[model samples]
Target: MLLCWLLFIPFIGGLACWFVSRRNPDSNAARWIALASMALVFLPALSLWFGGDFSLPSHLSASPDWNRELSVPWIQQFGIAFHLGLDGLSLIMVMLASVLGMLAIAASWSSVRSRVGLFHANLLWTLGGVIGIFLAIDLFLYFFFWELMLIPMYFLIALWGHEEYDRGAHMRAAIKFFIYTQTSGLLMLAAILGLVFAYYSETGILTFDYNQLLGAHVSGTFGFVLMLGFFIAFAVKLPSVPFHGWLADTQANSPSSGAADLSGILVKTAAYGLLRFTLPLFPEASAQFAPFAIALGLISIYYGAVMAFAQNDMKRLISYSSISHMGFVMIGLYAGTFLALQGVIVQVVASAISTAALFILAGQLYERMGTRDMRQLGGLFGRLGALPGFALIFVVASLGMPATANFIGEFLILFGAFSVMPWVVVVASGGMILAAVYALYLMHRVYWGTPQGQETIARMRAREYAIMMALVVITLIVGLFPNTVLSVTQGTMNDISHWFAAGVIAASQAS
Candidate 1:
């Protein structure tokens, strides 16, 4: 019941926000509706954080078990149910949704003047869909919400994004996002259908339930094709290298607020999907392809870092940096080591914190300078004072400075990668160097040298500082004592690790 309420609260509130315009279609009602409803969603998530157990009572860490769950027959005739659940994997994500959702509302507090009600409406709905993705155990429900998320986002980008985005920019970005994910969505649906049918053929049971499909048998070629379907869907969202073409345009044209949600929470769904759906669903294929996948992660790291160094536009640079960060996340995930999996958990949380912080700060910088060009940005460190220093901390943390959370994540990833494949680790190290180059270059260009006039030097606001400081404190605390996250995650990852090991051995024997 708590799990169901957690997902439904935002949805019901989002619908109510749409009606805010009826009494007075102004943005205030919409904003209030968004804020108030999101407040409701937070309660259930808080239960998991402080009261409910984040893990099972067992000694091992990783498992499919969720600490809180809700289930009821939705389509009993077809064996589908309104099944929803949460474990360490999704508990963290829902918590992120609540926090970032609140902050994004804050970011848009004064920035979005037009269609205020509509904006919050879209924002709340988008989150509802994301929460659905995290909790839905039914395949159909998962895909339904997956597509549900796409619509509100399309509106958010096309309607309220940067004015320079003009008319077609939003349409173009929205359409591109739709096409990429929709195509991949179709592929994933196919795989889901295949799994259900495969289970039915063997056991005379037709169900879209995850538990039922887990040990269903399939041939190598079959698993390979199905896994490809799932992988492509996850990869496009991860926006891994070749499939990443949509990210830059979306970030560049969309409102900074929309970009925050997209970068901070939306793209993460792909990584989450990879862990929850793709790898676990097709373990044999995943194990068979782990080495190749690790190579892709390595490639994305260096490629994104190098490209980030070349970009002068603030949004685009961070967009590319997101790519680089997810690269490490992907590598660690595929490594199948305990430490590496722990690194993935830290990396996901830290990446969201650090990258989103940079994006928000960049938005502030843009508001000040009225430009994102490196050449136009010169030292305002004296004028900006503490902000530049704070920005530097985020930058170095992003660059993986030794004591920062980013360093802890990278260290674990490298250590885990080395244990599995030393040569891959050797190559992946170059990404760290490239990250330094780009991060420092951006620092020098944006915050160093002389002041480019005194035009863009407004001191940081209390609200923005509060939001950023929260992110800062989280990075420090999580980095210093990683066990805070690791302890809860250890059991879950170990269960997942053993699951994949069996698949790897099976695949090897078959080959």
Candidate 2:
């Protein structure tokens, strides 16, 4: 019931916001309604997290576990159920979604003036769809939410995004985003049908339930083919190396709030899909594919970092940096160990917060200076006042500085990945050095050089300060006691590792 409410409130709130905006076009009611709805969501999500048993002992049982769940029959003919569940894995993701949901709302308060009602409506809808993605345990339901998320995001970029001296710029980016994600989604849908039909062929029982599908017996070439469908779907969403063409454009032109959601949570969904679906559903295939995937991660690390250095656009630089950071997540996931998987979870959370903070900061810079070109900006330290300090914090965090969550996540990923693939991990580690160069170069160009003009922009407002400070505090706390997140996910990662190993053993024996 509570799970339903978490999903329901945002959608209801969006309609209410639309109504409110329609009635009072000049009022700030739409923004407040969106913020209030997001705030309300945090309570239920928090309760779900604390209500669970965090102790590892609880996981000793050999039974499937779910801390909170709601299952009801839906679409009986297709074997789909309105299934939702929360475990340690989903709890953190939901929490991140709610937190960033609010920040994205707050970040839009002043900037989004045109179509205020419509904008807030889209924001809430996008968030509602994301919450669905995090909680839905049924594969069909998961893919439904996956496709739902993109529509509002396209509207967001198309209607409210930036256009630097070009007509239809935002629209083009939005179209590119739509085409890529929608195409990937079609691939995922095909894979879902394949898996369900495969299961029915063997057992004569049709279902789209995640747990039931885990027992699927498809193997050899057929299993490998089904796994490829899932992997490609997730990989496109991950926008890894070769599939990353759409990200830079989308981020570069998107409104700050949209970019925050994109970098912060949208991309993380891809990582989550890999963890939640691709690996567990087809573990043997994942193992067979790990070497090639790790090589791609290494390439992303170097490619993203180097390309970031070449970008003159501030948003593009941050977007490329995002690619590099996610590369570490790729390494940890394919490394195939409990420790490495834990690091992947930590990296997902930390990278989202840190990257979102930078996007928020980037928005702030654009608002003040009227441009995001690094070359045109200079010596903002004296002129912009305290924003430079906050920007510096995010910049250092991006570079994996000590005492920050980014540092902890990267260290663990590298440490765990080293055991399985030392050479690859060593090669990927070079990203840290390149990260430092690009991160500092951004800082040097934006805040430490000569001012571009005498255009005096306002200092950080209370709302902006609150947003950045909250992100900074979160990074610190997670860095200091990563166990806060690790403990919750430890049991889940252990179970997944076991599944991977068992599947590999089964596949080899069959062959």
Candidate 3:
């Protein structure tokens, strides 16, 4: 019941915000309502984090253990149910979504004056769909949420995005994003259907239930093809290398809040999907594909870093940086070790916080200076007061500075993956050096050079300061005591590691 409410609150609140805005367009009622709704969602997830029993039993099985689960019959003939489950893995993600959702609202508070209510409605709806993606265990249900989140995001970029040079640029970006994701999504849908039909043929049970489908006998060329379908979708969402074409433009044009969601929360879903569904559903195929995935991860790491260094647009720089950061996540996922998997979880959360903070800071700079081009932005360090300091800290964190979560995440990922794939880890470590170069270059280009102009920039507002401080605190805490997150995700990661390892052994033995 609580799980159901967590999924529905954002949607309900979005509608409520829409109605309230229609009645009182000028009032802050809609904002408060959306915030309250997000609060409602966050509170329950936090309680689960604190109070729920997530420990695994001494004896493990092929089936996973859930902290909470709810299933109701929806399509009996097809073996589909409205199945939802929560585990430590998902609990952490849900909490991240709720917190980021609220901050996105706060970020958009003043900048979005027109259609304020509608804008927030889309924001909340987008978040609702995200939570659904995290929770939905049924493949049918997962795809439903997968596609659902894109529409509101399209609206967010298309309707409210910045249009500096071209009026239609934002719309074009939105459409491109939609087409890329939607087309890849359809491929995943086909793969899902193929998996369901294959399972039905094997066991004479037609179902989209993930648990039931998990044990389905899928192998050979057919299984690999289906796995590719899922992989392509997640990769595009991850925006890994070749499929990352839409992300820079999309983030470059989107409103700040929208970009924050894209980098902070939305991309993490791809990592989650890979962890939760792809690896578990088709472990053998995933094991076979690991090497290639690592290669692509290497490409994204270097490519994103190089592109970010060359960018003058601050938002585009951050967007490309996200592609680089997520490269570590890809390597961690396929590294096939317990420690690397744990590192992947930490990296997902830490990167989300640090990257989102950067996007928010960029938005603030844009608001004050009316530009995000780094060439046009220099020596505002003294002029912007604490904003430059905030940028410096997050920029350092982005490069994986110690005492920040980014450092802990990247260190663990490289350290853990080195044991399994020494050569790959050796190559990936160079990305950190490149990362520092870009990070320092960003600071030097934007805040350390000669003053761009003598404009009177406003100091950080209370709301803005609070947002940055909150993120900084969280990053530091995770950096210092990562066990806070690791403990919760340990049992889950152990189960996945064991499952994948077992599949590897089985495949090798059969061969």
Candidate 4:
């Protein structure tokens, strides 16, 4: 009941804020209501770190059951359940969602003036859906939350995006984002139903509890196709290459808060889904497709960096940076090593922080300077030293600079890849160089390149400095002591590695 409460509280708060803010938008109640609600939501997520079983089961230390699972029947007829669970792999994602959800609300301060209630409604619901994604263990529940996130996000962009982006443009961007993810999201649902039906037919029992479905072996093309369905769904969200068209629209034009959430948290759900479901559920197919997936990952890194180098708009550049970082996450996933899996987790967290921080900086700039065009936005490093300095940290981190959190993740990912596919590792290394190119280019162009004729909004305010500093500290602390994360993550990664190893051994024996 308590775990479920933690999941639903944000949603309940959203609905309450909607009504209350509508009645009294003039008062601080609306903001406080939204803020307090989100803060409360953060508590339970953090509690999991200290309270739950955090160890691999000794009997199967290599493949322990994920900790603190909560399950109950919801739709028995379809084999669905009100199933929610977490292990080391998921708890970190949950914590990330909670922390960022609050930050999204904080970033909106003073930026969102019109339709305040409605905007908070969209924002809070977005967080709620994200929380749902982190908690849901049932396929149906997962898909339910997956689609549930779209509506609020769509409204966030179309209604609150910059006035300069005309209605048609905003509508087009919103619709494109919705259509792409929604269409692919359904394909994943179909795949889930197919897997469940197959399991029922074989065992005379039915369930979509992820635990039950684990290690449900299949052979031939069916296994491969099922894996494709899961991969495409996750990829659309990861927005890998051809699947990436939707990301820039959402990130570039969205309201600051929307952009923050999109970059900070929403994109993460897809990466989280890939690690939690796609690879583990269909290990053989994932392994089979490793080479092609690694190729896509490498391309995303170089391509995203190159594209960012060419961009004039700062927001769009950050969006491409996300594409590059997420690409590495995919690389980590397919690399299939314990260290690599942990790297994926670290990459997701680090990338989300850096990208989110970049956007928040963009929002602050937009609020002050009235534009995001990097060409018109120079001399900032001189006038707004602190702000540029903060931006530089996130920028360097995004570039995977050593002593930042991003470096640790990228290091493990490349090292892990070298073990299995040395050539792929070499190709991926180019992305690191490309990252430096873009990161430096962005720094030179926006902060130090040339001024836009005036030093409007010359410096960052305390609020802006505070938020950016918080993110900086998170990156540095984690960067310096990655072991804090690596310790908790090792227990889970070992289990996943054990499972994949079992499957691999089976394949080798049959050979």
Off by over 4 Å in 3: 452-456
- Regarding lDDT, does 3 or 4 come out ahead? 3
Question: Which candidate model has the greater TM-score, 3 or 4?
Answer: 3
lDDT of 3 at 452: 65
Which consecutive 10 residues in model 3 have the weakest lDDT in total?
Answer: 55-64
Candidate 1, residue 143: how far the Cα is off, in Å: 1.0
lDDT of 1 by residue, 222-311 (tens): 878888888888899987887899998787777777888899889989988888877777778998889878878988998899889888
Decoy 1 TM-score against native = 0.95
User: What's every prediction's RMSD, in angstroms?
Assistant: 2.0, 1.5, 1.1, 1.8
Best by TM-score: 3
Global lDDT of each candidate: 0.82, 0.87, 0.91, 0.82
Candidate 3 lDDT tens digits, 282-365: 888888888999999999999999999999999999999999999999999998688888899999999899889999999999
**Predicted structure 3: lDDT:** 0.91
Per residue, candidate 2 scores C-alpha lDDT tens digits across 1-511 of: 8889888898999999999999999999999999999888988878766677855544443423777789999999989999998778888988898899899999888888899989989988988898899899899999999999899999999999898757788899999999989988898899899999999998999899988998887677877888888877777777788889899999999999889988998898999889888888888888777888888888888899999999999999999999999889988988878888999998899989988988888898898889899888888886775789998998999888889898888988899878868988778878899999999999999898667666556988899889988998999999998998998887778877777776667757766
**Candidate 1's C-alpha lDDT?**
0.82
Q: Which stretches of candidate 2 lie over 4 Å from their true place?
A: 57-64, 452-456, 507-511
Residue 69 lDDT in model 1? Answer: 70
Task: Give every collision pair in model 1.
Answer: 21-25, 27-117, 60-491, 61-490, 61-491, 61-492, 62-491, 62-492, 62-493, 63-492
Instruction: Extract clashing residue pairs from model 2.
Output: 378-450, 379-449
List of clashing residue pairs for candidate 3: none
Per-model TM values vs. the true structure: 0.95, 0.97, 0.98, 0.96
Give the poorly placed runs of model 1, Cα more than 4 Å off. 25-27, 54-63, 163-167, 454-456
Deviation from native of the Cα of residue 98 in model 2, angstroms: 0.8
